[model samples]
Each structure stands twice: as structure tokens, then as C-alpha cells.
Target: MISNGVSGNKYMDGPDQVVPSDTYISCVPGGHVKLRQTSRGLASEPPISVPGLLKRTAARYPDGPALVTKKADGKWHYTTYKQYQERVRTVAKGFLKLGLERYHSVCILGFNSEEWYLADLGVIHAGGYAAGIYTTNSAEACYHCLESSRANICAVQDKKQLEKILSVRSRLKHLKAIVQWEEPVDTSVPGVYSWAQLMEMGAAEPDTQLDDILKSISVNECCTLVYTSGTVGPPKAVMLSHDNLTWDAFVIGEQVGDVKPTVDKIITFLPLSHVAAQVVDIYTTLSNAVAVYFAKPDALKGSLVETLREVRPTRFLAVPRVWEKMYEKIMAVGAQNSGLKKNIALWAKDKGMKHHLARMNGQNGTTCGFKLARTLVFNKVHETLGLDKCSTFVTAAAPLSADIKKFFLSLDMPIMEAFGMSEASGAHTLSIYPRFRPESSGLILEGTETKFGGAVSPHGPGEIMMRGRHIFMGYLNDEAKTREAIDDEGWLHSGDVGRLDTNNLLYITGRIKELLITAGGENIAPVLIEQQVQAELIHIGYAVLIGDRRKFLSILITLKSKVNNDTGEPLDELDTETAKWVAGLGSKAKTVSEIVNTKDPAVHKAIEEAITRANKHAISNAQKIQKFAVLPKDFSNHTGELGPTLKIKRNVVYEKYKDIIEDLYKE
Candidate 1:
């Protein structure tokens, strides 16, 4: 037997409970399970089911906009909280009416949109797991996710996604029906339903069956599945419980103060298949009653700024690549300025940087100089980027470069860095503005515990171990991997190596698997050296180190190049910013082939000087890049050199450039 728990209330486990340890207690509904127990919890808010939280938010903000969408009519539309809740109920009932079984899964494939959110929550409401597939995934990848999750129903955004599902439909024995949200779907295929048909089916079914399923819901049961990106190995299905989603969202909002209902809004375009987007764009918005506006399908191609201008959201979260692109665009445009305008802009940027740095160090930053700069230069930049109203700017999913951070700070827009993975639901350590340190992952969430494992001291560059109510249930259908991730002590061992400062802020160094060991027994984190090279050479987009067990380090570099708008494939032509920099180098080369085939002397000398300058900052000779080669083209998602979150796949890069790496190390 186990006692029910409320906010801040403590209860003891009975004989039936299988608590993981004495330090932690089980707060999950029903009998306490072994691996799901946690030592830390939020004292201010009670645990809630996903659907229950939606219902409460609807009651509190009935008329407030829950979802704002722009249709093909070229106009914005609003769905109030009350109506959003009603539609969710209708979809949930429809799922049950169409034979959705308890604990089964519904696979959703699409970009972020209203129908996507409805399907995600509706599946959870009807006692099924909602699994999202990356819109960039191939049909084979989709089949793997659907099979791993045991999906019975599939919901897709458009005909393109529907085609992929249909290609794999025959092999999936459990799949019963397919629902296409976007029209022009060939519904001539049997067992394929339209969005209108789904609603109509819900209208015909009674709510009693859905209500009964809701009554049997438990906060500890898995409601969603996040499949890993499989950069190194096969993707694992990350099982997230209802409590994990609700509790994580609550703490995230609490950390980001002043997130009031109907006031704060967010524009979400990041892939919802990732845990960060689901936590920030969906659950957190629901918890705070914050309005969410969906970006256009082609937002990443070139239209993201247009959407940002229209929405002007209060909070913005993006991966580092997005911010880097924005920085490059601004620099390209600034290059066109001349004379007094350029001088004024540079002066303003200097003042802005000094002002923010003063404030970051707890000094008084308000002065006439800063005020003038804000009015003259910083405000214009904000207006151009439509970030005038955005108070919180966050960067996550991968490590951000020091140069990029400094650039943003010079514009008086400090982008806070956050750290988390799918196993932790979403954010574990967050850096809110004013409370954030430069290059740190901010403070750990209030109800989470963190420690450095296998370290000689408390603050160490060791494996990060964390435990909290926000911890995920387990990997779906992989008990061995689950046990390996979370030990008997209930601490989820993150493979990331990091150190904590005296202020309790986290600074991630590198991943254990990504570490390089030299012949003389020196361990080096490649990212630091790679980032230094890129910082010194502003025209390069990627600098990948090529030493793991060798005597010294070498690198593979790529010049900044244009990418295919439709497929994200890297093109040989230099980008506008890079081309301008190249022209300034006294070279007439335009494409990467021109630079490589002709062995441009000016460009080669610049790269050598940049590397020599970068090596001056290296900790030791072994860590310094001894040799380097410029790749023919840049790395990108289409080439499988980068992951979905724009993180470099080191193994893939090494394999692709093995000959170049060998030539560098040849005696």
C-alpha cells in the first residue's frame, strides 16, 4: 500500500512499495515502483496529468489564445483555450472510437502546426503514447520508430508524409488507420481518414468511453515517446511519464519569471520531435497559458525572420546554427554600410558590450553612454530582427561558440545557454537572463539534484549525474540500456563531462565518447580546440579535429558555403559573408573548387596564420592542431555529417575524410 501525495506533502512507502533507495521516496500514483522514485520534487505545485493540466488551463483562461495559426488565406487565426480544450476532447474521443488501444502508440509525422499539437495531446488523453517522427527522417527511419513504439494509428501533416507512411504501412501489422491533416490527400486508399472525418467520427461517439480511460490514468505511466537522433547507433525510444512532462514544464516557467497568462507568447519552429521543443513550445506554454504561434513550413529556408517580425514573441529558443546564421546575415548587411554610419555602428556595439558586461558582473550599467547607444544603434538592430519584445533568448541542443555569444552580447542581446537531454524530459539546467553567467549552463532547476561522478573534488570535469522528478520513465523495450543509464542509486548518469563552479553553475566540457587521447597519455576535448580554430578564422563554418589515439592533432576545415534551400545540401559556392571576406583577402576565388584546385596562396596564408594564432591558446602541444586541410564543401544535414540539431557527427566526418586525415599524419 502507498499513500497519496499532494504538493509538498511527504508520505511513506508500504510493504508493496519497491523504493529504489532510502534517500528517495516514491510519489508515483498506484503502488510505488522501483526505478521511478525520486528524491527531489516541487513543493509549490502538485503533480498533474497532461490532459488534466490542459483542462485547468482552459478553465482559467477561457478566452485567451492558446494556439495562433496562419492559414493559406494569408491571415492569422486564433483558437482560445476553451476551444482548444474542446477540440482536444473531440480528437481524444475520436481516437477511442476508431479503436485506439490503451498503452499503444500513435505516430505523428509533420512540421509544427495546430493539427500536430492536437494529435499529440489527443493520443495522450485517450490513454496512448504520442510518438513524433522527425520531418527529415526517411521512410525506413519512420518504420523503425513506428515499429519500436508499436503504433496502431498514424497522423501526418501533409501528402508528403502520408506517402512515406503508406510506403511502410504494409510491414506494420498493428497499424489500423492513417489520418492526414492537410488536404489534397488521396483518401481513395482504404483505412485512410481525413481530418474532417476524424472530427466527424468524434462527434458520433459518446464521451463515456474516453472518460473511463481518463479515470484510470496515472501520472507515472508513460504518455509520450521521444526517439533519439541515432547519430552513432540505433535510436532508442525515450519514455516520458505524465508527471515528468508536467513537473518539468512548471519549473521551466517558474525559472523564466513573469510568464503570465495571455501576456507572454512564443513562436515555435524547432522540430517538436526533440524534447526541448516539446517542453518549451507545448507543455510550458500550456502550464502558463502562454499563446503559441506556429511558424511557416519554410521558416528555416528564409522566411523565419518574416514570421518573427509578425509575432514578436516574448521568449525565443533556437539551436546554435540558427543564431549563427542570423549573426552572419547581420554582418553581411553591415558590410554594405560605409563612412559615418559604419563608425557609429561600431561605437554603439562597443558601448553595448561594455554596458552588458558591467551588469553581468553586478555593477551599475545604466549610464548616458549606454542609453545613447541603445537608442541610436541597439534599438534599430532589435527592430530589424523583431526581437524588440523578446525578453528571454535561449540557445540549446548543442554547445554554442564563444564568438557567437560575444557577438550577441555586443548587440545587448545575451543568449542564455541551457543543457538537457530526452531522458530528463527537457531542461535540467537553465540560464535565465540577469541570473546567467557567461559560458555557464546556469543553475540547476529547483527540484533537481546534480553531482559530478568519479571526480576527485565536488566541482569537477566528470560525468554529470542527475536525479529528479523530471527523470524519464525508461527506454521503451530496452531494460538493459535503461538500467545502464539510471543506476541503482536513482541517479541518471549523463555521459557528458562537465564541471560546476563555486556559484553552482554547470559548464559542459565535452562528451566521454568524443574525447581524444594522445600517444603520450594526454586527454583532450576536441570541441574546445575546434571552436578556437573557427573563432580565429571567421570564414570557416566547421573545424573538425582528427586525432583520437594519434601522436598529435590535425583538423578538417570547411569554408562557409551556400546550402540547398529545399534539401539542406551544402553547395560549393561561398556564402555572401564568406565571399566578402574572401574578396578582402586579395583573392578572386568564388567557389570552394576554385580555392582548392588553384591552391590560392592568399587564402592558404590566412588559414595558416589563423591556425598559428589559435595554437597559442592551446593547453599543451598535444592538444594543438598540428596540421589542417580545407574540405571541398561544408557539412550539412543532407550529407549526414550533422545531426538534426546541427551537432557534428564526428564519426561520420572521420569516415568521410579518412584519406585527408591520413595524408596529414603521413611521415
Candidate 2:
């Protein structure tokens, strides 16, 4: 506990327990591996309360650019730390005036924004629990949260969120009011007020009343109900305490380079509903005093390049989709360049790879060749991607390919892959310097105890079991399910199938519940196979491997492949075979839809060849995909085929294509 803030705790189920803070034995392939957390989350304990953390940061850097947002006309709006503090105070007062009692739940449904920030912190400051609903959730999903959390009030961002709330308004007997950042279109809804009106109403209320409530709040009290995305199943609400959040902020700071108040900057675009984004971008940023730029929801899709160029964040984190597009674009530009430029680029890429390897070997020195490559190659590469200032670029919420990780490291913009879930505030493990394992999810963080246990019968990796302060209290309002998650031994069953390497590095193999057992009695993890497809195949937006209790493995491939898997670049021109194939499909173009319904010769050859290549890595015939069917459209959040983080909604997709799935096994 000297530095890591984790006291010695035994991991075994027996009575005799004397395990140390930085020592735990993990199961590896053939022998036991030792794991430790030498570094601490914070050098010293952080502030106990979320509001107290904000106030201290404000006092230190009152004039610093705190909350930033770009306007409709393209001009940037800055909300200084001082202004941010004042607004949070005012909003807290408003909550008090509206009769929000201690531990009252308030739902904030929206994308990231300044108002959303105020509403979230204000609820905590006023001693209320804040729950966030994803902007991508349907009315039914939103309703479930509203009823489950028993939120007395809702602060929705726009009409879209409001419409969902209204859809189930009659069922929310506990909801007393609704406040909105955007102007309400319909004035007929009772107990609804515009943000301006709410603030004005609170302006007449006494500030001391809210102050007393904030001061009495304990660190162990529930602060937020962070719900899981439920990519493979129904969502569950995780109750994370104030201590849980404040500690994670410090852990994140220690893991990556710390978020500095006047120095660091980041533009947040991930859904506020997700634990990772909320903890890192909002709570962690506020606690560390980092500047946060809130990207407009509409502009999020198209303005990434422009925003990155303008903000040039010192610390950046994104989901896999963003990283994929950036990597593809850079690779494309390098391919399209002329003779001199292309030669220089390729030479630089080679040198950069060596530089990365050197770093991975724990050597800090850059060779003379790498220095020249940096001068000619990497510096420009960073600028083009608006990553010149980025010291840490993290990818989480979904598994990132090892190839993508290496590509950025070659550019000197290392992508730190991390793993976590809402059940545990934000992160449990991360790949960092000196201990970097691009293929694995890195070592366990301070205070977290994870061990593999209860593998599905005798085959495959065991399910991950974790017990730590980073873990949540329990599932909200569902005691039966809560007990099912965290056992009597205090371990929170992760339900993910994984293994710890001899070096303590964690590799997530699959979801225990999502495993597919074939007719041959061979157990297979679909996600692992899906990852292989993504890495090996061209134009694969998503891959759904289906072979549970079936004769052999077959897959559904959603294609919109941007580049050829072999070259990492777009086809110079369609090959004669593919062109002829397209001709047969009655389309004169090479596109996803054009090839989706046709037996286009080139498309067939490409997919078949890709499948054959993927099969080389398979351990058994049951693991290899024997056949695949193409989907016309890519999985999307709007269509409810994907979760907020872009993970496939397995049940929804299966239901949508029941007929197609039936036909696949017909022969």
C-alpha cells in the first residue's frame, strides 16, 4: 500500500490469507506467473468528493480553458474553470430548489456537452445520483433505465432524447420532473422546464441549503449508475461510489502521463453513457484539471479531422472505429503518393518499425536512422493526423487489432489498448510503456485482483474473476442479479473467458456466455474468430461466426472493406475478374451492395481466399469457417444492429436474419 494505494489482500477462497499488495499468482499456459502493481494510482490519496476535486482544480487554475465547445459558425467557445465551477454551483442549487432529496436519481440523456457536464456534476454536488442513458438507445432501453434507476428527474439534451422519455412517460411513476438543455418543442408535457427556466428558478433559492447537503455526502455513497452497453444481452446498471470514481481518475493519471490543468487538452466524442468515456473524459478530466472540448453531436461524424487539427490534444482516447478510419486514410495517402514521396514514406515506415521494436525492448535510445526517419517521416505523419501533440492515444471499449497498434507505434503515436467494463468504473488493465504488450490487454491496475477461474467445463480459458475497490457496489435495484454477479467471497465474476500470460499480461479470448459448442463437441469462442476475420479479410465491417451445435462453422460477413487486406491500400482498379463478376450482378461498380447479392466472381474469390487464409490459424476443423454469407448492409447503431460502442447486437442480428441462418444449414 506504500505507493499503489492497494493494501495486501488474499485472493484465494481459503481462510489462511497473507498475500501482499504487489504479489499475485496467475495461471499461464504451463506454469504460474507472478503479477504486481509497483506503481500507484496516485502518489497520494486524491480528494474524496467529486465536488471537492472540482473546487480544488478551479482554485488552482481558475482562468484555464476548462470546458470547450465548437459553435455552429465554426468559432470555438471556451468555458473557463471559474465559470464552470459557478455554473455547477448554480445547477446544484436548482436541483435543491426542485426538491431533489439526498440520493435522488437524476438521468442525463445526451451526447457529451457543456450542459451535460454541468448537469452531471451538479447532481453529485447536490448529493443526488446521476444516471446517463446512451443517445443510441431505443425507447424501450431508455424506459428500462428510467424505471430501474427510479430517477426523479431527467435532463435530456434534445427532442430525440425527449421523445424516448415521453414514449414511456406514463410508466415512470417516480419521475417528478424533466429539465432540458435544448428548448422544449411541446409545452404540454407537465413538470417540464427549459434549462434557463430551471436555473432562474434556482437563482432565487438559498445556496447554503445545497452546500450543507454536499458537505455531508460520504465518499462511499453511490455517485452514478453506470449501465453496461449490453452488446450481447440486456444492460445492467452498476453503482459506482464517489471513492470509486476519484480513485480511478488518479489511477488513469498514473497509468498514462497525467492530465495537466493548463497543459493537457482532449476533445470528447464518445457516448457519455459509457463508463470509459464518462470516467476519463468527464470525471477524470475534471479531477485532473484537464481542458475538455465537447464536440457537437452533428459534427462528430465529419469534423474529426478539423477538430483534431484545431485542438491537437495532448492526451487522446478513441474507440476502435476511429482508429481504423485514421489508419486506413494514412495508409491510403502513402500509397497514392509519387515515386520520391512513396520511396521516402516506405523507407520511413521501415525505420519507424525498428524504432518501435527498440522501445518495446525497453531501450529508450533512438538510432541515427530513426532520428532521420523522424525528421523526414514521423513528424509529418503526426502533423497530417493532427497528432503532433498527442503523447498518449488510448483505444478501449472494444478490442483493437495488433496490426493497428503497431501501425501507430511506427508513426510514434502509440495506441495504448485497454480493457474494462461499466461494472468496474473505467479501466482494469492497460498496455503502457516499459511493459507494453500490444497483443494482450496489459497488466492489472493498482487495487484490482483478477484470476482465471471456472472455465466452461474442462476446455478453453477460464472466466476472469476480479475483486477490488475499483469494482462496483452491485447491480442497481436487482438484489438477486446482484448476488449472482458478486459472490459471497467478494469476487466480481467478469463472465469473460481469458488467460493471464507468464508476464502477467492479460489476453481476452472470448465471452464465457457467448461460447459456441459445435455438433462435434468442440467449444469455440466466436469473438476470437471474429477478430481473426477482421484482421485477415478485406472490407469486413463485421463478422458473425455461427456454429453452436451445428455441423461446422459458418459466418456472416458484412463488407464495406476500404482496402485490400494484402496491400493495405485501395485496389488501383477493379480486376478483370471482379469487373466481369460485377457485370454479372448487373452493376457497373465495385461496391458492398453490388457484390452483396451477386455471385460476382471477384467477390467470391476474394472471400473464399480470405477464409482459407484465416483457416490456417484455426486449431481444428470445427473452428474453421466452412462457408460464409454476405450481408447487404453494415451493422449500425441507428438500425439497432450495434451497441453504442459499435459492438454487434447479437440477438437482434440473429432475429433479423433467422431465415438466412436457417438456409445456411439447409444443405
Which candidate has the highest lDDT of all? 1
Top candidate, metric TM-score: 1
State TM-scores per candidate.
0.93, 0.87
**Cα lDDT of model 2 by residue, 144-203, tens digit:** 888777778889988878888988999988888888788654556787778997788777
- lDDT (CA) for every model shown? 0.84, 0.74
Error of 1 at 42 (Å): 2.9
Candidate 2, residue 127: lDDT: 72
Q: Which stretches of candidate 2 lie over 4 Å from their true place?
A: 1-47, 184-189, 231-234, 454-461, 561-587, 590-593
TM-score of 1: 0.93
Which portions of model 1 miss their true places by more than 4 Å?
A: 1-44, 455-461
